[model samples]
Target chain A: MSPQHRALATREAILRAAAEEFDRLGYDAAPLSAILERSGVTKGAFYFHFPSKEALASAIVQVQDDTWPRLTGQWRDRGLDPLRTLIGLFEEAVSLLSRDVVLRAGVRLAADRDVGYPGLSSAHLRWEKVLGDLLLAARDAGQLRPGVDPEAAARTLTSAALGARLISSATCRCADFPERMREVWRLVLPGLATDEWCPPALEVLAAPQEP
Target chain B: MSPQHRALATREAILRAAAEEFDRLGYDAAPLSAILERSGVTKGAFYFHFPSKEALASAIVQVQDDTWPRLTGQWRDRGLDPLRTLIGLFEEAVSLLSRDVVLRAGVRLAADRDVGYPGLSSAHLRWEKVLGDLLLAARDAGQLRPGVDPEAAARTLTSAALGARLISSATCRCADFPERMREVWRLVLPGLATDEWCPPALEVLAAPQEP
Candidate 1:
């Protein structure tokens, strides 16, 4: 492998190890020494990449953002109908959160630990704004129902999605978090759905029956 | 005041001050010296009431639980028909959260921090059972539709409520957390609602906008 490729691989390895440590022990209790030991990397290399644990946290948040399709790009590409994109994005998010433990942990931590962290908050707001702008764009297109507050509705939907994940992960015994999530979304999405799309048939999505 | 009254007053004062300090600075960062100053008590008295900060934290959680009406009583009273009651509880919780920053912070901290702390998880589970039992009762009464997993659904609702608080607090300015909570409950309740009531109608009961 090229020198650049080797460096990238080492960085990704450190981040994966850090994510596991942070998730298992939490942000405060997780120590750099433990991460170094787990990653099998020397202290010098870890410090070279991340000056502090908080900096490493920022890196993790960035990685999470990069892994998903950017909300802005996704919405904008939907041909001026942002609401369609917004729903699609949430559907995608539910899928990602259901399938990936790292994503779920990262999201929960984002809600809990990163509220006080500026870099994380900024990235979070940027994402929220992308959603907010989509709402605004939909409003401009006359797709939203009358009297809807674009920003407020957007935040409400965003918050509900986060809430769905929290519910599924902490409480559900079901193996796929997404399975539970779609049900929560069905209840949540109708209120936010634009006048253009007929409400998806409100079905009673249920748990798999035992043998 | 009598001597006994004075002593009791001092202890309560210390606990109130300790709660504020602990909530703001967390267990490790909150110094007893500051709490002592806030309560105007000597270190001897502070140590007399509480041996360590951990003890103080435990006391604070206990005091809050006593003061707060968790879902337990609500679930019991509305046992056979809990869909509306559970939704009503979230509505009440959201309004209460708006007025009390301490409660909001404390609850979120309890959810995140208590997993490692002894006794807390058990207490949390006990609360969960209260909610679970209510859901089971509702199922037997035909409130929850067929194929709805009572335990899983109850946990999902609880987790969503916690996550909603986190999101609301995290983005306090962008959204009114209380109102958004109503929106969340609106979505969650319908799936669990009986055939006669539609979800939006519950919103009118919980949060009727002025004419």
Candidate 2:
């Protein structure tokens, strides 16, 4: 491999190590030495790629942020209904969070107080906007019930999803996240969707495959 | 004051200071020196009362736990409907969390990653049981719908409340916690309660006074 290709590979290895460290031990408790050991990279290579722990954490957040558009774009390309598309996005997240150390670490780092990252709230705001826009679109398409405020629904749903994820992580190591989210939708959709949309929404939630 | 009374006061003061420190700086970053400075107590006196920061955090959790029974007892004594009483209990918590630094501090400490206090999960378990019992009563009293499972509802509501409180604290310093909770109940109640209970439940939520 070219020297540049090797450099990129080393950078990716360092980030993966940092993400796992943050996910397992949290930001404050996770040490740079452990990350270096986990990555099997010397301190020189590590610092050459990422200067500080904060920089490594920020890169994780950035990488996590980059995934959102790609995930959502895939659903949008499928031409599914807006609400189904939203559920699809979250389902994708749940799957990623369950298996992907980098994404899980990104979430942990975002919420870690000692890390001092503001990305968590911004991420919430972005998701709220995305969900709100989708709900509005569903309403426009006569999918949502009349008089249901899309913004309020979006805010509540976002909060509920976040709460569910946290509780799942704490109580069950997120083993039941997809199931918990299904319960959230079961309770929330009735108030948001018209009768005609309920069946398909449930179908989307129940189906194992991506839309 | 008697010497015993003075000691008790000193202990209380130290706990308060520790709680505030943990709440503001989080567990990993909060220093014992800052706690001592905040309490205006000597290091010796602080150590005399609480052996360590972990002990101080445990004491704060204990104090927060003690408040729950007293608050719930007050609602139970009023002979209010079960659903209303449940709402009252949470309403009381919101009020305390708003004005009481110690309670807010306890919550922040419980959620803090570096703290690692199992008391937090136990507290959640306790609340879930309390809520589950209340929800079962509400179901029996015909306040809740016939098919709803009280245990599941209780778990969801507990998780949702925790999530909402976290979001509120981070986003608004919990200035809007009551309003945020109101929205939670607004969305959750329709699924849990019968139609007849809706109006009264809404009224219970709207009332500023403790029921």
Candidate 3:
């Protein structure tokens, strides 16, 4: 590989291993030595890439930002109905957060102490806007139930989804996250979406790949 | 002072100081020395009250259990309707959690990488049962809307409140927790409770002291 490519690979290696340490041990408890050993990178190489433990953590959080918009764009491209896309996005976000070590570490670090609240983050805003925009589209298409305020629905959806993620993590270590989310959506959709729209959306959420 | 009384006072001091340390700096980050200094106790005195930092944490968590029942009973005595009582409980729980250092420490420790999920705790079960029983009572009283599942409502309320607490902690350090809970209830109540019941409950939640 070219020198530039090798440099990129080295950076990625450090991040992956560091995320594992942080996700397993938490930011305060995570050991820099463990990260370096896990990454199989030399001390000089590690220092060249990340000057401190905090720097490595910041990168993981930065990568999380990069991941979100791409995933949001990909799901939107499927051309499914808007609320359907919204449900699909919720399910997929939970799934990714459950299994993806890097993303999980980013989320955990982002939560530690307020540099800021995730609610106030651009990502939070972006996430809310994504849900909000979808709800607006659903409303325009008459997919929402009568008198449903799309903005409230969007904020509720975002907050509820955030709550479900933490709740599942705290309750079952995310073992039953998809199931927990399905239950939440079941109640939320009937309240927020039109009668005709909710049933199929629930069906699709229960089994996203079945066409 | 009586020897036994002084011992109890000493124990309270240690727990209070330790909770401040733990809440300020998470479990792994909190220093034993600072807890000792802040409590104004010697190491021997501190150990006499609590064997270890984890013990202090355990005691704090245990103390939390004691606090819950007393608070629950006190609120129940107010003789409000089931739904209002429910909203009152959420608001109070969030309010207590926001400012009570001991409760904050217990909650933070409870969420660490896990001996278990808070959801599986007896406290979680009790919390769920409390909400569930209230919802069932509401349904029987015709305060709940048609087709609202008391069991699901109970679980959802429990999860959502748990979520709201964590979300607020992560987002704003709980500065606007009351406002956040109010927003969540606004979206939630309409779905689960009668329209007439919801407005007044929301009003009470917005200002709990007013008649």
- Which candidate comes out best when scored by DockQ? 2
* Residue lDDT tens for model 1, A48-157: 78899888877776656676656446645767456666666655666665655466546545544543411123444555677788779777876666656777665555
lDDT tens digits, residues A21-75, model 2? 8876667788988999999999899989988988999998778778877887888
- Give the alpha carbon lDDT tens digit for every residue of A1-211 in model 3: 9999988999999999999877665677788999999999899989999999999999998877788888889889999888888888878887888777799778767665334332123455567799889889889989998877787677666666666665565555566666666767766776777778878887887675321
Q: Indicate the residue-level lDDT of B104 in model 3.
A: 71
Task: Give per-residue CA lDDT, model 3, range B1-211, as digits (tens).
Answer: 9999999999989988998877666677788898999999888888787888888888888777787788888778999888878888877887888878788777666555244332123466578888888789888888988877888777676766665665566555566666666666766776777877877876776674321
Candidate 3 residue pairs that clash: A117-B171
Report the Cα lDDT for residue B166, model 3: 56
What lDDT tens digits, residue by residue, belong to model 2 across residues B7-28?
9999989988887777666666
Q: Per-candidate interface C-alpha RMSD? A: 5.6, 3.9, 4.4
**Total clashes in model 3, counting residue pairs 3 or more apart in sequence or in different chains:** 1
Candidate 1: stretches off by over 4 Å: A40-58, A65-71, A97-127, A136-152, A166-175, A194-211, B66-71, B78-81, B94-109, B116-156, B170-177, B187-195, B198-211
Name the candidate that leads on TM-score. 2
Tell me the TM-score of model 1: 0.74
User: What is the model-wide C-alpha lDDT for candidate 1?
Assistant: 0.59
How would the docking of model 3 be graded? acceptable
Instruction: Name the docking class for model 2.
Output: acceptable
Residues B1-211, candidate 1: write the lDDT tens digits.
Answer: 9989988888888877876665455566678789889988888888888898777777766654764555446544765346555555555556666665445435544643555421023334554565677678677767776667787666556545544555555556213666666655555555555666444447455566322
